[model samples]
Target: MMHTSVGWHVEMEFREDDQHTRAVAMVRLPDGSEVRAHGHASRHQTDVNQPRVGEEIAAARALNELAMQLLTKAHGEIDQASGRTSHPIHV
Candidate 1:
């Protein structure tokens, strides 16, 4: 049996104000490539102020986008290696 171990670390940063929250999510691949995604959340005029909720929403969106990007990248690589179009990859 052959065994291999790999690990990836993701970094997330957020910026928030009274009405808006912005988040950036990044991951560094083993092949010396970096992928990043951004997300934003806006507070409604009548909504309660909850910084944590805003941050969570923004971060989740950013991470979701990042996952989609990674999947797309893998799909492209698979197609390139196989020399044919592959099935669609979804989040």
Candidate 2:
């Protein structure tokens, strides 16, 4: 029997404007495929001006979206391997 271990590196970037913060998350797989997702957070009139909070929220949302996309891709691959039509699989 044999075992193998694999790893991937994920990166994230954040940008901010006067009223909004944007985040992008990216992952590059060993097979040269890349997955990326974006998320944003907006400041309201009543909200306190907090840059760190905005960055945290935006980055978390972007990572969440990225995770969902990766799960969807995995589900599609599984369906193809099993000779079945791809179906929406909620995570």
Q: Which candidate achieves the best lDDT against the true structure?
A: 1
**Which runs of model 1 end up more than 4 angstroms from their true locations?**
none
Off by over 4 Å in 2: 86-89
Minimal lDDT window, size 10, model 2:
82-91
Question: If scored against the real structure, what TM-score would every candidate get?
Answer: 0.93, 0.85
For residues 1-91, could you state the per-residue lDDT of candidate 2 as single tens digits?
9999999888989999878999999999887999999989999969889988899899999999999999888888988899987777665
Q: Rate the local accuracy (lDDT) of all candidates.
A: 0.94, 0.91
Residue pairs in clash, model 2:
none
Per-residue lDDT of candidate 1, residues 1-91 (tens digit): 9999999999999999999999999999999999999989999989999999999999999999999899889989999999998887563
The TM-score obtained by model 1 is 0.93
